[model samples]
Target: MAKKVALLQGNEACAHGALYAGCSFFGGYPITPSTEVAEVLSGELPKIGGKFIQMEDEIGAMASVIGASLTGAKALTATSGPGVSLKQELIGYACIAETPCVIINVMRGGPSTGMPTGPGQSDVMQAMWGTHGDHAAIALVPASCQEIFSETVRAFNLAEKYRMPVQVLYDEIVGHMREPVEFPEPGELEVIDRTAPSVGPEAYKPYDTSFGDVPPLAAFGSGYKYHVTGLNKAEDGFPTTKADLVDAEERRQISKVKNPTALADIESNEEYLTEDAEVIIWAYGSTARSSRYAVNELRKEGIKAGLFRPITLWPFPEKRTAELAKQAKAIVVPEMNLGQMILEVERVAMGACKIAGVHRVDGEPINPGQIIAQVKEVL
Candidate 1:
């Protein structure tokens, strides 16, 4: 049978993708470039018997998601830059408690309401370090409307599989632009739910690492009652002040996604003609679209230019990037902000390649000409 397809804005695709992933609850406060996600879900969730709530603020919205997720609801929330800032404290709570919830952050200009309707990739670093702690982070950056749909689904899977908060961020240009999205049939795309504890309520601990670093998460009121807290916890779920236990717990949480095995599954990127290229364009989100155009133009002129787009921003794609840095003589990074992701590219390149950046934070999208010019100068 032919797949059902539609012209969808990135935000609408995200809403439908969440539904496809069996998301049962959405708790969010409306914010520019992302409000459509809430609007679409508002009318659709009830028809499917799912719950949708608009909280008084971003913090409340995020808090509601973590709370509902505790009850095993495949919960999600949507917001932009400012809202994300407000949600950071609770995001930290979700991380430490090991809650599985998805956050859709439509990228807009920032530093406190910089540009509600403009595109910005400045939040790239915030997604990893915004919560203020030594915890693991999984952030997906999709460059198109169709990818936003599929990556939203992938975001939920990673959140559940890793038993933590996962973020999906796309620029406002991608979020509001319309494109055709082919919907995946039932069972076509992989859907992962949090593992359930096999042990009965009599023998369940929320942070039981004996089952592995990522232990099964039992839903609240599902015949399993376990303590959930923001404080450092032992395997039994109670707060631990012991230095050894605290140190071990912290290490375990970060190692869950930082280790080589975990990084292999969490890191994703795209390489276009990078094998023989002398200059590589490193971009993500909407800036990648322009970089692709620049690469083609440069190739037509007989220049060795390629594009390396990072789909999973966090986990950094360090190893592959280091390889690219060695293979290419120069790396050009174009982003919607003043050198946000360029920092990551530079750190990984470690002076192995000539690195340059094309930055724009003045409420404007970075164009192909800008990327092309930067690539030329770096070469």
Candidate 2:
């Protein structure tokens, strides 16, 4: 039997991926480069008997997602940079409250509505640090429309499994670009939901560690009433300022994603012809597509070149990156922004190899020719 496929835009793929992942609630306002995601869901969610709400603004959208997710619904929201800035506070709230939700941030030029049409990867760091306080973040960056759909599904899985917010960030190029996408059958792709508590309502706790680091979360109206707060909290989900309890809880939250065993399941990357390459291109999102092209071009010229693309952005893929830094003589990082992800590569490289960046922020993408030139210049 042949599977049905469609020439779908990246945003469209994301919407279908959410449905495939069992997302029943969508709370988002329309924003450029990402509007299609909400537009598609607004129509499709109702058809599937799910809920879709166009909130007043980005903040309200984020708030609604948190509320919906607490009721045991797989919730999601999509926005660009400006909208993301507005949702930062609520993003932090979701963090402290330990809710599971997915946020799709399509990167575009700007600090504040800079260039809506011009794609940018400047939001990479913000995805990790936009929210206040000390908390762990899981963010994914995919280069193509197919990856956008697949990674969006994975983003939901990570959020539900870890009991935290997980984000999928891509540039306007990939978000608006059209590509052939094969829809996964109902059971083709894995869908993960938050762990449910086995205990009766009388003994349920939102952040119970007795069930292990990630406690089972019971639905809000499931006859289980538990406190959730922005302030530091104890295991019972109530506020706690006690030094030992606060320290333990905070550490546990961050460690859940940072722990070696946990990180193995969270961090993802792709390396191309890196075994004997002297120059490696370290890039993500749309820039990585160009980098991959440059690697092929450089290899043709007898320069051993390869690409190391990060699929999971948050945990930073530190270990694998460090290994590549040591193996390669130099690494070239070209991004839509001045130089955001390059900073992380340098930190992990720590003088292991020479690193340089090719940056452009004029609402244009860095071309493969430019990446190849940088590789030669470094060589």
In model 1, what is the error at residue 96, expressed in angstroms? 0.5
Score candidate 1 by lDDT.
0.92
Task: Record all residue pairs in model 1 with backbone atoms less than 3 Å apart, i.e. clashing.
Answer: none
Output the worst ten-in-a-row residue range by lDDT, candidate 1. Answer: 336-345
**Residue 372 deviation, candidate 1, in Å?**
0.9
lDDT per residue for candidate 1 within 1-379, as digits (tens), equals 7889999999999999999999999999999989999999999999999999999999999999999999999999999989999999999999999999999999898799887989999998999998888888999999999999999999999999999999999989999999999999899899999899989999988888889889999998778888888999888888999999999889988999998888888889998989899998999989999999999999999999999999999979888889999999999989888888888888988999999999998888898998888888878
Candidate 1 regions exceeding 4 Å error are none
Superpose all Cα atoms of candidate 1 onto the true structure and report the RMSD in Å to 1 decimal.
0.8
> Across residues 294-378, which tens digit of lDDT does each residue of candidate 2 receive?
9998899999999999999998988988999999999898998888889999999999999999999998899999999999999
Q: Per-model C-alpha lDDT, please? A: 0.92, 0.93
RMSD, one per candidate, in order: 0.8, 0.7
C-alpha positional error of residue 318 in candidate 1 after TM-score superposition, expressed in Å:
0.4
